[model samples]
Target: MTAARRAGGPILVGLPAWVYLPAALGGLFVITPLLAILLRIDWANFVPLITSESSRAALIL
Candidate 1:
């Protein structure tokens, strides 16, 4: 067995602070667009909008 495995400890203890900045930016990049879409939703008419014929066709496609 490897020395690390023999020690019975985690292989990766922690990450550097610099690593977190890019990780956070990547997460925000992906989530921001979805959040913007959700924010712009007309909640009161949401069901009708999704149930519309055009929407159903698009979903089927």
Candidate 2:
């Protein structure tokens, strides 16, 4: 047996490739839309946009 596998020694295990793929894709899935919204933000209209009637009504609720 390998030294790592011997009694009281540290044992190591390998993870499957498939495990990481979903996690990576999920991270991208969540971040992509938020990034898109941030990218589309109009700095010039930032204040007026958020202060509009609809925006105020939405915030009040």
Candidate 3:
């Protein structure tokens, strides 16, 4: 028992496939909106658009 304690543990725990399934689904749920906004952005003008006065005011509000 002392040797096992020094070695870290006697019992090992593992995540189930069901746990991974929910985690994957939750990740997709959270990422979808971010991906949508990324897709809608104009990459070439992104910096200018984000820094414009109107955009800044909207964000501040």
Candidate 1, after superposition: displacement of residue 19 in Å?
0.5
Assess every candidate by TM-score. Answer: 0.74, 0.61, 0.68
Worst 10-residue lDDT window for candidate 2 reads: 1-10
Where in model 2 is the C-alpha error above 4 Å? Answer: 1-17
C-alpha displacement of 29 in model 2, angstroms? 0.8
lDDT of each: 0.86, 0.88, 0.84
Candidate 1 lDDT by residue in tens digits, 1-61: 2223326676644566688899999999999999999999999999999999999999999
Predicted candidate 2 versus true structure: per-residue lDDT over 1-61, tens digit per residue: 2224657777866677688899999999999999999999998999999999999999999
Relative to the true structure, candidate 3 has a C-alpha RMSD (angstroms) of 5.0
Candidate 3 residue runs with Cα over 4 Å from true position: 1-10
At residue 12, candidate 3 shows an lDDT of 50
Full ranking by lDDT: 2, 1, 3
lDDT (10s digit) by residue, model 3, range 1-61: 1122336557655665578788999999999999999999899999999999999999999
Clashing pairs in 3: none
